[model samples]
Target chain A: MYLEIKDLTVLYDRAMVLNGVSLTVGKGEFVSLVGPNGAGKTTLLRAIAGLVKWEKDTLKGTRAGRITLEGSVKFDGEEVTNLPAHEIVRRGLILCPERGRPFREMTVLDNLRAGAFGCKDKKVVKENLERVYHLFPRLKERENQISGTLSGGERFMLTIGRAMMSQPKLFMIDEPSVGLAPKVKEDLFARVKEIYEQGSTILMTEQDVSFAFDLAGRNYVISKGHLVGEGTAEDLLADESLRKTYLGL
Target chain B: MVEAILINGLVLGGMYAILAVGFALVFGVAKILNMAHTAFYMVGAFLILIMTIMLGFPSLPSIVLAIAIMGITGSVIYKLFLDRVKEHPVAVMIISVGVAILFQEVLLIGFGGHFRGIDPFVRGFVEIAGIRATYQQVIAIATSLVALVAIRLLLSKTRVGNAIRAVAEDREIANVMGIDVSRMCVITMGISAVLATVAGAVVAPIFMVHPLMWMHPLTIVLAAVVLGGLGSIKGSILGAFILGFAETAVVFLVPMGAFLRGAVGLSVMVVVLLLRPEGLFGVVFEEERL
Candidate 1:
C-alpha cells in the first residue's frame, strides 16, 4: 500500500471524531470519502495533515489504530504526529484545506510562491511555477490580483493552483464543491478529474455524493466518525439500500 | 511660532516613531503587547551610558554594542518566556508586565536610581527657522528617517518581511505555506529589540537615563500604538507625532507645563480612541470570543 491508515481514532477536545477508522490508498489512485454532515471526513484528513490538536486527547494505545505512510513513516521515520503543519508540506504531502482559505491580503503570485517555500532548489521552484501556470492559466493572468478580491469559484481555482505549486505526491482537498454554484461545481469536478488523470493521487472528502461518485474510483460512506459502508463507484451507485441507509442517497 | 513647534515636534516625534514602531511590529505580528519593550530601550540607554561614560568608548561603537546586546536579550526573552505565552494571550500580558517590573528593579538595584547623561553623539547645532537644533538632534532625525525607510524596504522587498506579514495577517495559513512560524516570531522580537535599543541610545544623551526613564517611554509607546491602530507601522508614526506635538505644544503654551503634560497626552488618545476604536489607521483586530 502506498498509504495506509489502520484503525485511526481521532478526538476533538472530548468528542470522538474518528473511532478506529482504517483505510488505504494506492499510488496515483483517486479516492473520495462521502459522508453526511458532522461525519468526521474532514477531521480524518486534518489528522493526516497533523493539524488536529492531539495534546488534550487520551489514546487507547492500540497498535491497529496507527497511521503509517510507506515512504518515510517507517519506524525510523520522523514522528510527524508532533511536528507542525509546515513540516507536513515540506514532506510533499500537501493539503488544500476546506473553506478555500488563501492568504487574503497577499497577491495571487505571492500565494503561489509561498507554496514553493519548502523547496530549496531554485530550478525546481521555477519549473513548479511554470507547471502550475500551465495547469491553471486563470491564475497566471490574475497573478498580481489580491486573493481576497477573488470570487468564490476563482478562489477555488487559486487554492488548487497554490497547492499544485507545492509539487505534492498526493493532493488532499476537502469539500471543493461546498459553496460553489451547481455549474461551477460541475466544472471544478471536471478540473479535479483532469488533475487525477495527469498523475497525482487524490484523497478528497465531500458531502455531495452524486458528484463525488462521478469523480471517485472508490467510495466510502462515513457516519458520525465511523466508516459505515464502502465499495467501488459502480457498486455504490447500483446499491440503493446502502445509499439510503448510510449515505441517504 | 508653530513652525518651531512643528519642526521640533517632527524631529523628536520621528525618534518616538522608531520606538513605537518596534512595539507595533512585535504586537502586530505576534499579538503580544510586550510591556518590557520599553525596558529594552532602557537597557540600550544604559548600555550606551556605560560604554561612553565608564568605558570611554566612542559614540558610534557604543550605539552598535547597545543594539546588539538588546537584540540578544530580546531573543532570549522570546525563547525563555514568550514562546510559552503564545497560546494564553492574557498570561503573556501578565508575564510581560512582570518582566517589565523585574527589569526596572534590576536597573534600580544596579544603577542606584541615579540620573546619568552622556555627551551628544554629534557636536554643534544648526538654526532651522530660528529654532536652534543641535547636530545630535539632526543625526537622530536623519538616522530615524533612514531606519524607517529601511524597515519599509525590508517589509516590502525581502522574503523574511513577506513571511512576517503573512504570519501577522494569519498564522495558520502561513504554516500551510511552509513558513517556520515560531522562527519568524523570534526574529520579529529580536528585530524589535534592536529597534528599541537604537532609539534608546540615540535619545539617551538628550533625556537623562535613570532607572525610571522607561516609565515615560512605555506610556507614550503604548498610547502611540493604540492611537495609530494595533499592528500598523504607518499608524504608529502618525500617532507618535500627534501625541509628541500635542504634548510639546501644551507644555510650551501652558503655565503649569509639567503637571498638565500627562493630562493632555491622555486626553488626546481618549478622544481619538472614542472617535475610532479600530484606530485612526482603520486597522481592526478580530476579537476571539469564547
Candidate 2:
C-alpha cells in the first residue's frame, strides 16, 4: 500500500488505453511492468504521474474534446489522482518520460540544474546536482556541452541523471534502455540498480523480458490495456502460457 | 546631416526594438503572436496622455501607473482568453485580433478622433557623436539599452527566468521537470506587456497619441520579428535597428523620402527573408516550432 492504484481507466475519445487497472508497490520494492508494444504500460505510468490528468483537464471543452480518466492513485496513503504534474513532482513522484527529450537548447549542466528547480533549499539543490554528476561522471565531463549534441548513450545518462536531481521517493522510468546498444544498455541498467540501492523505490517498464526478469523482484504482464498476469520473475517464468503468450518471453 | 540621421535612426530604431522585444518574447515562449500586444502600447500612451493633460498629474508616476495597468490587462488577456484557445493557434490569433479591435474601439469612444499628446518627461539636450539630441531621445536609447541588458541578466541569473526559457524550448518537457508551464506562460505575457507599455508611455512625448497608434508599431514590429527570425530576442533587436535605419535613410537620402518610408523598410525585410528565410540571427537548428 505504499504506492497504490485502483480502478484506473483512461479513454482517448472512444478508445480505452487503460482498463480498470490496479497495482501496488511496497516501499523500497523494485517492480517491473514488462510487455510488448501497445500494452498500455506507458499510459498507466503517465496516469499515475498526473500527466494524463493534466491532458484531460487541458483538452476538455476543446474541439478535440473529452478525454475520460477515472482512477485513484495513492502515494504514501494520499490520493494524488487529481494533482497537477508539477504538484505531483513536488510530492516526490517524478516521471522520467520516454526518450531523453532533454531541453535540447540548454547545456548539460543547465538541464541537470533544472531538475532540482522545485527544491527551495539552494544547498540541497547543489548537493543533488553533485550526486547526479558523481553517479554518471560522463555527465560531468560533458557538463558544458549542449544536450542536443550528446550521443544516444550520453542522452540516456543525462535523462536518468536529470530525474535523480529531483530526489524522488519513487522513480517511474519508461523504456530507459530502448535504442541503446547492448553494451550501453548493460551500463545503463547497472546504474539503475545503483539508483535503487541508494534508497529510491523504482517502477520501470521494459520490452526486454530477460533484462526485466533479471532486475525486478516482482513483475506484471500487461497486454492490450489490461494487467494480464503478475508474480515474481520465477513464478511467471514457470507459467509457460503467460511467458509465451503475453510477455513473448 | 549624416550624423543626425544616424543618431535619429538609432533613437527611433531603439524604440522599435523595445516595442518588438515584447512581441518576440510573447511569441518566443507562448507562440501567441498576441495581436493585442500593441493594444497595450496604445492603452499606455493614452493613460499617460489623460493623466498629464486632463488631470495635470506629474508624468513619472503617471507613466508607472500606466505600465502597471497594462501589465494586469496583459495577464488577464492570456489567462482568460488566450489560455482557453491555446490548442488552436488560429483561434488564439483571431481572439488576439479581436482583443486589439476591442481596445482600439474603447480608446476611440473615450478619447474621440482628435489627437492627444503628453509633455516631455524630461527637458534638455545633449551632444553625442557630434549630434545634438533632446533628453527624450537620450532617454529612449538609454531605456531600451538598459531594458535589453536587464532582460539578458534576468534570463541568465534568475530561476524563474530560466524556467521561462526552458518552457519556450519545450513546454511539456519543462512541465515534467516540475516547472509550471501555464504559470510561466502567463508571467511571460505579463513581462511582454510591461515592455510594450513602457515603450508606448516613453514615446508619447515625441509623438501624438491616438486610437490608431497601435497599427504602425504592430506593422513595424511584425516586420521586425519576421525579419529577425521569429521568437528570437537578438534577431528582433537587430531587425528593429535595421528597419529603423532603413526607414530613416529613406527620408534622409531620398527626395520623396516621406512617401517611401514604409515601402523601403518593408522591402529590406522581404529581400532578406527571401535570401535568409530564418532571419539574420535566428538560431541555426532551433525553429521555435514547439
Candidate 3:
C-alpha cells in the first residue's frame, strides 16, 4: 500500500465521527470514497490530514495508523505526521478541502505563490506555476485580479491550482463538484483527471458516486465511518444491490 | 485662537494615528487586541528616558534600542503565550489584559511613581506658512509619516509581508498553502510592538513618561481602533487623527482646560460608534463576530 490507514478513529467534540476506518491507496492510483451527507467522509480525510483533534476524544480501538509514501513523505521521505500542516504539505501530502476558497484578499498570482510556500527551491515553484498556468490558462489570464472577484468555477480552479503548487505525491480533493454547474463540474473533473494521469496519487470524497466511480479506478463505499465495500469501479457499478443500498442509486 | 487649536489638534491626531496603527496591525493580522500594546508604548517611553538620562545614549540610538527591546519582548510573549492562545480568542483577550497589568506592575516596581522625560531631540520652533510649530512637533509629524510609509512597504512589498496578509485573510487556507501561521502571528506582534515603541520614543520628549502614561494612551488606542474599525491600518490612522484633532480643538477653544482633553477623546469615540458601528472605514466590522 502506497498509503495506509489502520484502525483510524476520529471524533468532533464527543460525537463519534469515524470509527476504526482503515483503507489503502496504491502509487499513481485514483481512489474515490463515496458516501451520503454527514457520513464521516470529510472527517476521515481531515483525520488523514491531522487537522482532526485526536487526543481530546476517547478511542477504544488501536488508533495507531501509518502513512508511508514510497520514500520519506517528501523527496527524502521521512515521517511527517508529527509536523504541522505546513510541514505535511512540504512533504507533498496535500489536501484541497471542500468549499474552502482561495485567500480572497490576495491577487491570483499571490495566491499561487502562497501554494508553493514550503518549497525552498524557487526554481521548482516557478516551474510548477508555469505548468499550472499551462493547465488552466484562465488563471494565467487573470493572474492580476484578486481571488475574491473570481467566478465560482474560477475559484475552484484556483484552489486546485494552489494545491498543485506544493508538487504533491498524493493529492486529496473533497467534493470538487459541489456548488458548480454541470459544465463547470465537467471542466474541473477533466483538469483533476489530467493531474492524476501526471503521476500523482489521488484520493477524493465525492457525492456524485457515478461520476466519482467513473473517474476513479477503485471505489470505496463509506457508510457511517466504515469502508463497507471496495472493488474495481466497473464491478461496483455493475452491482445493483450495493448501488441501491450504499450509493442511493 | 483657531490656529493653535488646529495645530494642537493636528499633533494629537498624528499621535493617535501612530498609536492606533500599531494596535490595528496586531489586531488585523494576529486577531489579538494585545492589551499589552499600550503598556509596550509606556515601556518605550521609559526605555528612551533611561537611555538618555541614565545610560547617556544619543536620542537616535536610544529610540532604536527601545524599539528593538520591545520587538524582542513582543516576540517572546507571542512564543510563550499568544501562540498557545491563538485558537482561543476569548482567552487571549483576558490573558492580554492580564499581561498588560503585569507590565504595569513591573514598570511601577522599577521606575517608582513619578513623571519623567527624555530631552527633546530638537530645540526651538519652525515658522511654517507663518504658523509657529515647535520643531519637536514637526519632527513627530515627519517621523510618523516616514514610519507609516515603511510599514506600508513592509506589509505590501515583501514576501513575508504578503504571507502575513494571507494568514490574516484566512489562517486555515494559509496553513493549507504551507504558510507558518504562528511565525506570521509572532511577526505581526513584533511589528506592532516596534510601532508602539517608536510612538513612545517619538512622543517621549514632548510627553512625560510615567508609570500611568499607558492608562491614558490605552483609552486613545482602543478608541482609535474601535472607531477606525478594529484591524484596519487605514481606519486606525484616520480614527486616531480624527479623535486627535477633535479633542485638541475642543481643549483649545473651550478652555475647559487640558485636564478635560481626555474626555474629548472618549466622547469622540462614543460618537463615532453611535454613528457608524462598523467604524470609520471597515467592512465586516460587526459581522466579523459571526
Candidate 4:
C-alpha cells in the first residue's frame, strides 16, 4: 500500500467525529470516500493531512473543544501521524481543503506560487506553473485577477490548480464540488479525471455519490464516523443496505 | 509659522508611521494586539543609550546591535509566551500588557525615573522647502521613507513576503500549502520589533527617553491603528500621518495646545470611527479582514 490508515479515531471534547476508521490506497490508484454530511469523511481526510493535530495544538485553550486524535497514518511507508501539516506537505502529501479557499486577498498567480512554496528549484516551479496552466487554461487567463473575486467554479479550479503546483504523491481533496453549478461541476469532474489519468494517486471525500462513483476506481461508504462498506462501485452498489442508508441511491 | 507647522507635522507623521506600522504588522499577521510593542521601542532607546553612552560603543554599531537584540527578543516573546495564548485574544492582550508593565518597572528600577537623552546621530540644520530643520529630523524622515519602501518591496516582491501575506490572509490554508504559519508569525514579530526599535533608536536623540514615555506613544499608536482600521498597514500609515498632522495643527492653533495634542489626535480618530467604522483602506467585512 502506498498509503495506509489503521484504527483512526478523532474526538472533539468527547464528541466522536471519527471512530476506528481504516482505509488504504495503492500507488496510482484513485479512491473516493462517499458519505452524508457529518459522516466524518472530512475529518478522516484532515487526520491524514495532519490538520486535526494542528487544530489540537493551536487551539488548545480557546473556545474550541479539546481534540483527541489516535491512530497510525503511514505514507510512503513512513508514519506521519505526528508530523505537522507543512512537514507532511514536505513529504508530498498535499490536502486541497474544501470551499476553494484560494488565499482570497492574493492574485491568482500568487496563490499558485504559494502552492509551490516548498519546492526551491525555480525551474521546477515554472514547470509546475506551466502544467497547472495547461490543466486549467482559465487560471492562466485570470492570472492577474484577485482570487476572492473569481466565480465559484473558477475558485474551485484555482484551488485544484494551486494543489497541482505542490507535486503531490497522494492528493487529498475534500468536497470539491460543493456549492458549484452543475455545468461548472462537470468541468471540474473532467479535470479531476484528467489529473488522475496523468498517473497521480488520489483520495477524495465527497457528498455527491454519482460524481464519486463515476470517477473513482474504488469506493468506501462511511456513516457516523465508521467505515460502513468498501469495494468497487458495482460491489458496493449491489449491497441494498449501503445503497439505501449510506449512499442514498 | 505655517512652514514650521508643515515641517513639524511632516516630521512627526513620519515618526508615527514607523511606530504604527510595526504595531499594525503584528496585529495583521498574528492577530495579536501586542501591548508590549511600544515597550520594545523604549527598550531599543535604552539599549542605544547603554551601548553608546555607558559602554562607549560607536553610534552606528550600537543602533544595529540594539535592533538585532530587539528582533530576537520579539521572536522569543512570541514563541514562548504569545504563541501559547494566541487563540484567546483577551488573554493575549492581558499578557502583553503585563509584559509592557514589567518592562516599565524594570527600566524604572535600573535607571531611576529621571529622563535621559542620547547624542543625535547627526548634528546641524539643513534648509528644505524654505524651512530650516535639524539633521536629526531629516534623518528620521529619511529613515521612515526607506523603511516603508523596503517593507513594501519585501511584501510585494519576495517569496517570503508572499508567504507572509498568504499566512495573514488564511493561516490554515497557508499551512496546508506547505508554509509554516508559526515560523511566519515569528518572522513577522521579529520584523515588527525591528521597525519599532529603529523608530526608537532614531528618535532617542530628539525625544527625552524615560520609563513612562512608552505609555503616551502607546496611546497614540493605538489611536492611529484604530483610526486607520486595525490590521491594515497602509491604513495605519495613513492614520498615523493624519493624526500626526492633526496633533501638530492643534499644537500650533490652540491656546496651550501642546498639552491638548494627544486629545486632538484621539478625537480625530473617534470622529473617523464614527463616520467610517472600518477605517480607510480597511476591509469592510469582518470575515475578510487581514
TM-score, chain B only, every model? 0.94, 0.94, 0.94, 0.96
Per-model clash counts, in order, read 0, 0, 3, 0
lDDT of 1 by residue, B1-290 (tens): 67657666776687779889989999878788898898888888988988999999988888898888899899889879987656666778888878888888998999897988888877898987787778877777787888788888887667688778878877766776778777888899999999888788778877789888777777788888888888888999899888888777876777887577667656767877798877878545343231
Give the clashing pairs for model 3: A72-A77, A72-A78, A73-A77
Question: Which run of 10 residues does model 4 chain A get worst, by summed lDDT?
Answer: A56-65
User: What value of lDDT does candidate 3 attain over all alpha carbons?
Assistant: 0.79
Candidate 1: clashing pairs of residues = none
Residue ranges of candidate 1 with Cα displaced over 4 Å: A54-79, B127-131, B284-290
| Candidate 2: residue pairs that collide | none
Individual DockQ of the candidates? Answer: 0.40, 0.66, 0.45, 0.83
Stretches of candidate 3 off by over 4 Å are A54-79, B1-3, B86-90, B285-290
Task: Rate residue A102 of model 4 by lDDT.
Answer: 89
Tell me the chain A TM-score of model 1.
0.87
- Candidates ranked by lDDT, best first? 4, 2, 3, 1
Each model's interface RMSD (Å)? 5.2, 1.4, 5.1, 0.7
CA RMSD of each candidate after superposition: 4.4, 2.4, 4.4, 2.0
Model 4, range B137-172, lDDT digits (tens) per residue? 889888888989988899887888889999988888
Report the lDDT of model 1 for residue B272.
75
Q: What is the C-alpha lDDT profile of model 3 across A156-219, one tens digit per residue?
A: 8998998898788889898888888999989888999999988889999999987898899998
DockQ of 4: 0.83
* Alpha-carbon runs more than 4 Å astray in model 4: B286-290
**Candidate 1 local lDDT, A191-237, one digit each (tens):** 99989999999988998988888888887888898887788878876
